[model samples]
Target: MPHQPIPPPHRTYARAMRAEATKPENLLWQALRNRQLEGFKFKRQVPLDGYILDFVCFEARLIVEVDGGQHSGAIGDAVRDRHFEAQGFRTLRFWNDEVEKELDAVCRAILHEAEGRIG
Candidate 1:
């Protein structure tokens, strides 16, 4: 079943992200922080309009989302994806399992995508 889209709590969620919903995000952030990953700068838990992104690189107009099993299906995710695409941001989604079980692969995929955008 598709999960329901929980609209971001707007501006406030941006500030409280550190305390409110930091874990799932942190698991990814820890790997991307501090100009890491071949100097790829990623911003975490960033607020963009009505959404909070797992990771973003404004220069690349890229939004990388790490989704858990509960986010399965096409309904909610599709809707949210359309919104982001409409706003000129390209989104890349990966399952949490993929990130956890295939960390190097996930990192390589992200780098490959970024490289594609660069050229």
Candidate 2:
């Protein structure tokens, strides 16, 4: 029998997060999954650089985060964004309410950012 290596903690955590996605995350995912948004592929609960991103479009180097109230004015988020930026990726964030109330606008913003980055 061949030995199977255990997945890293972050990878395992990411998988867990995918299974336990929030309502806003699920809503946004429906809009982004299967290349539904302008044929751009988006992945949910992706682990990268020791962080678990809510959604990521590698081709576009864009990351979308659906945050709840706990994330408002969070300094950690700023640091995370800077880290991703340094890695040549852009981070986009939306509040839970925003996603629930303005899903169309959220998708539009994501599409626009993806197009710009893809360009």
Candidate 3:
């Protein structure tokens, strides 16, 4: 089992991460923040189970990850996904390039999944 996350430290780290978001992260955040995408609110760099999610829609129980090349075939991600799944959260992963090059499609996919969960 994964260790329980200490909220205070994790929150601090999440804040720092938000401040240093990558270009793709920034682009995706702009599209996901507030109620910009299909009236669903997204919070960036949210900490859960000692992991910071790129974006999350709490109401929809959806976690969106904007991953770079380093994440390809990462076993840690698979473990994290299982952990989130056990917490009744669904994760959607998109490559950084996909977010940068095909942002509209990414947003549409997120909206579609969120709608299924929320509506």
Query: Taking the tens digit of each residue's C-alpha lDDT, what string does model 2 give over 8-83?
Result: 9878899999999999999999999999999999999988777789999999999999999899899999999998
Instruction: Please give the lDDT score at residue 36 for candidate 1.
Output: 76
Off by over 4 Å in 3: 1-5
Model 2 steric clash pairs: none
For 8-110, candidate 1 gives per-residue lDDT tens digits of 5755676687566435466667777786767778887777655778888766677899887778896877887888788777889988877777777877787
TM-score of every candidate relative to the true structure: 0.79, 0.93, 0.92
Q: After the best TM-score superposition of candidate 2, give how far the Cα of residue 100 lies from its true spot, in angstroms.
A: 0.8
Q: Which lDDT tens digits does candidate 3 get at residues 50-91?
A: 788889998998999999889999999999999888887899
Q: How large an RMSD does model 1 have?
A: 5.9
In order, the Cα lDDT scores of the candidates are 0.74, 0.92, 0.91
TM-score of predicted model 3? 0.92
Full-model lDDT, candidate 3: 0.91
